[model samples]
Target chain A: MFDFFIHVASIACLYGVLALSLNLQAGFTGLVNFGLIALFGCGTYGAALASGMGWHPLLGLPAGIAMAALLGLFYARLGRKLSSDYWGIATLSIAEIIRISITNEQALTGGAQGISGLPLLFAGLKPYDGMARLALYVVVLALVWLFCQRLVKSAFGLSMKLMREEPQLARSLGYDLDRIRRVVMLVSSAIAAFAGFLYAHYLTFVGPDQLVSPETFLIWSMVIIGGVANNRGVIAGAFLMQFAMAYVPFIKDALELPTDFVAAARLIIVGGGLLAFLLWRPKGLFPEKVGGSNGR
Target chain B: MIEAKDIRAGYGDGADILTGISLSADRREIVTILGPNGCGKSTLLKTIAGYVRPRAGSITFGGTDVTAVPIHEKVRHHKVGYVPQTDNVFGTLTVAENILLGARQLAKTEKEKRFAALMDQYPALAGKKTRKASALSGGERQILSLARALIAGPEILLLDEPSAGLSPLMMHEVFDAIGAIRDSEGMCILMVEQNAFEALGIADRAYVLSLGQVAMTAKASDLLEDPAMRKLYLGGEVHAE
Candidate 1:
């Protein structure tokens, strides 16, 4: 039971990092970055390509972040002419393009077979034992959480929120919209890339399938259902969603339900929850910043 | 000092809203543009602020031709401070943050100093420093907008219909604030206002615009006391001088 709990906790931490990164762009900036999966995929591919060539896994982490940032710059440049639903479409198209490229780039990404035998994060530490792995993962989670908390409270974060709420007002106040959007996109993508590195190393495997649209949809749902603008809410939503996915087998087996029915039931629960949240609380559980209330 | 010579500007290739509109404001002077609705008063202010480019002629400030300077560049150089009519303050940002953002181009130390000075000048804003701009009343928002623009320490302040949609009491307060700013800072102030009588009373000089053209220009007191001017433009009624 302890081992199971630790494994669940570790996965939750990974997803929490992913959701937090997405929140930076979507929640604060009101940028519908559907191409988030592209950044995540870039990180995974960057790490896999670097480590597959026998480089240090730690070195691969920064490489992943750099690759993701570059992609974010590209997105920022393209996203300038688009807004509202058009922006969403543009980003979604970009994500699809990234996925297709990964699938076609057999030499670089190993195509469908994916990459394996990737180096562990800390070679000196034993990760086969569940508790040790869980501890290390928690450490990573804590670091990311602290960094995100500080980032959302900084001046840049305030600028992003202002831009999100009213771009015209932001412009009048001397905010260069293009510059702010690009920087925010780069930073958010880099954070997401870092989370990707963690996932790659955690699984000891990386694949193109992991960077597809379904994963993007899952992350968006997690952010929306958890709370759009709340950092802590994203973490909670990610954990809840991951826990549901992970524990479905136990629920199914204990209830003597068929595998297909269990899969359908899980989807129904997640879908219903997401719909209810959106219909009832469009701003999510924690609304954006309120007057005089420092978001804690 | 600022000058707009025969400036023609509009939303697009349509009838020029500000047709051959020439005006000037000297340092330590209040120049008010008074006109009826649909006149080009606000457009004139926007053109001067670099928010709208004049289709013809030049806008010279401090003896430099800044007719083509972008809005952000103009703001960075402190050449112009614009207080838009509505929704000028960023609703999501705190009043303090909004003021800080206005002075973003200044040095960090200078920005801090200006922020402190503004807080001292506008005591009503002090208690609301940490409050979101959206939570402020309309009058407070207007004051915050003016404060934000002033924090940039602009050489020329462009105010667009500051008295629009305000209670009479609020209008008095806003005009009082403007008077204090002009008296203390000695900055060049250009304002577009629908409240013709009140604007002329506060202005050092007043320009009357009709159909995007300057109809008359004179001292504010003379315009306010002119029976013919009052009968023709001031709501078709002549008050005893």
Candidate 2:
């Protein structure tokens, strides 16, 4: 049971990072990035390819982040022409294109077999190694949460909030809307890619299937339920989601349901919770606070 | 000085709302544009502010042809301050933050100095500096917008419909604040106003636009007394007191 909970806690930390990254783009900046999983896949593929070539995990991690950030910048430039509604579809389509290409390019990406035996981030441990690894993961998560907190309170963050609420107002006050949007995309993508690096190394494997729509939707649910622009809320949301995901299997066993039925039930439960939040508490558990003097 | 020469502009593919309109305002002068609804008065101000690009004409500010400069560049490089008729102050930002948005490029000491100076000029804002801009009354909001723009120390200020929706006494207070800004800063101001009598009262010069064309251009006092101008554009109401 200790092992099971440590595994769940480690996964929760990784998802918390993803949630915080997405919140920067979607919640603070009002960008709809439906293709976030595509960027995550890029990170996974980048780190896996590097590790497969015998590179250290630290070097591979940066490679993944850089690859994802380039894609994010490209999409941000394209965003200038596309409205929000269309941008969501465009991003979703791009994710599928990347996924399909990875599936077809068997030689380069190991094709459908996917990459295996990825270099472990924390390999070679002693007694209670699982708990130690989980503790380290929590530390990393705390650092990321602190970084996001500082960013959200800075002047750049204020400009981001302004861009979300009133682009015209932001532009009139000397903020270049295109530049701000592009920078934000790059930053968020870098953070998401880092989360992917951790996931690839922790699991010691990475497959294109992991970069599916459900993964992206799960992160969205966390952001929506925790609080849109609040970092603390996002972390809380991530842990709550992990708890739900773990407990559903226990329910399946207790009720003697089929394994396939549990998968469908998990989706229904997550979707229903999201709908309930939208209807009852659109602002999530913690709503965004106004910035600047009034914000204090 | 700021000048717009024969500017033709419209939204998207629509017909030109401003067809070859030319106007100018010099330093320390309050130039008012008075026109009926749909006469393109606001469009003229927008064109000068670089929010609306002129198709065939040019806008020169302080001897530079900034016809193609983006709105952000106009505010940062050209020192242009624009206050839209509505939604001028950010409701989510504090009153001080709204003012500081334009003053970001200044040094901390300079920014604080300007903030202090503005508080001195507008005593009402001094007390409400920590309050959200949304909490302000309509009249106070107009003053907040002016304070925000002036905090940037702009060389040219463009105002659209400053007295759109206000009681008569509030309107008087807003115009008084505008006149004070002009006298204190010695900056060029071009305003589009529907309150012709109140506008012309403080304006150094006034232009009456009819159907996207300049119908009359003269000293504010001259336009006030001109019977034909009053009959056509000034609602033929009470003369300037």
> For this target, which candidate reaches the highest DockQ against the unseen true structure?
2
Q: List residue ranges in candidate 1 displaced over 4 A.
A: A1-4, A51-59, A112-117, A120-130, A262-266, A282-296, B5-23, B33-44, B52-58, B90-135, B205-241
lDDT by residue (B1-241, candidate 1, tens digit) is: 8888999999866888998989899988999998778888888888888778889989988888989876666777655788888877777668897777787678989989999999999999999998888899888999999999999888888899898889988888999999888999999999999888878878899999999999999999998888888887776463554
Give the per-residue Cα lDDT of candidate 2 at B10.
87
lDDT of 2 at B234: 93
* C-alpha lDDT of all candidate models, in order: 0.82, 0.86
Output the number of the lDDT-best candidate.
2
- Cα lDDT tens digits, model 2, B1-241, are 9888888988878898888888899999999999899898988888888888888888999899999898889999999998888877889878888888889899999999999999999899899998989999888899898888888899899898999788899899999999988998899999999999899989999988888878779999898888888888997667634
Candidate 2 deviant stretches above 4 angstroms: A126-129, A258-260, A293-296, B13-15, B210-216, B227-231, B237-241
Q: Candidates' TM-scores? A: 0.83, 0.92
Per-residue accuracy of model 1 over A1-296 as CA lDDT, tens digit each: 77788879888888888888889889878888887888887778778988888887788878899899888998888876666578878888988987877777788788778898887655565555666767777787778778877877777767777778777666666667788889888888988898888788878788878887777777887898888878878888888888888888888889998889777866766787788888998777666554322332
State fnat for each of the candidate structures.
0.36, 0.64
